[model samples]
Target: MEVAYRIHLTAILSVTCFLLKQGLPFRGNDESSNSLNKGNFLELLDWYSLRNEEVWKTVNQNAPGNNQLTSPKIQKELANACAMEITRVIVDDIGDNYFSLMVDEARDASIKQQMRVVL
Candidate 1:
């Protein structure tokens, strides 16, 4: 059971990272099971499971409802965790070194003003 849980988590995390890397939105307008497109994250997971038996069993069938780790909150937490790890790596690589920071203001697809920071 423990191994199965780990596999399930790994599969979800892989999909989450892929979406994050692509700068894609995680949720769709309708995410019901019967919906044609159940959002990028869920749709990706389903697509992945079709090619991996262990992931398919662990995620789609065997995982407990409470611990499926597919909630919106879980997705946010996973992305946050990935971001923190990336920041840690960057910081470690620049340890004891001076680095220049750049900031820029921009608008996203929704025309929302945002700040971009680079280290």
Candidate 2:
């Protein structure tokens, strides 16, 4: 059971990384099972399961309902974790070295003001 759970998480993480790298949206307007398009994340997982038997068996119907790990909150947590890891790597690489920082403010597509920082 533990191994299966790990496999399931690995699959989810892989799909999450792929979507993040592509800068794609994770959720759709309608994400029900009956919905034709269940968003990029779920759709990619389905596509991934088709190519991997272990993943297919360890997720969705095969896994326990409580351990599905398919919630939106779980997805956000994974993304945040990835971002933190990236920041850690950057900091480590710049350790004890002078680095330039840049900051800017802009509005997004939704007209929401946002700040960007680079180091």
The best candidate by lDDT is: 1
Model 2, 1-119: lDDT tens digits are 88998999999999999999988889988999899999999999999999998999998657988887788999999999999998899999999999999999999999988888888
Instruction: In angstroms, give how far residue 6 of model 1 lies from its true place.
Output: 0.9
CA lDDT of every candidate: 0.93, 0.91
Model 2 segments more than 4 A misplaced? 103-118
Estimated TM-score for each candidate: 0.87, 0.85
Residue 110's lDDT within candidate 2 is 100
Model 1 stretches with alpha carbons more than 4 Å out: 105-117
Model 2 RMSD to the real structure?
A: 3.0
Candidate No. with top TM-score: 1
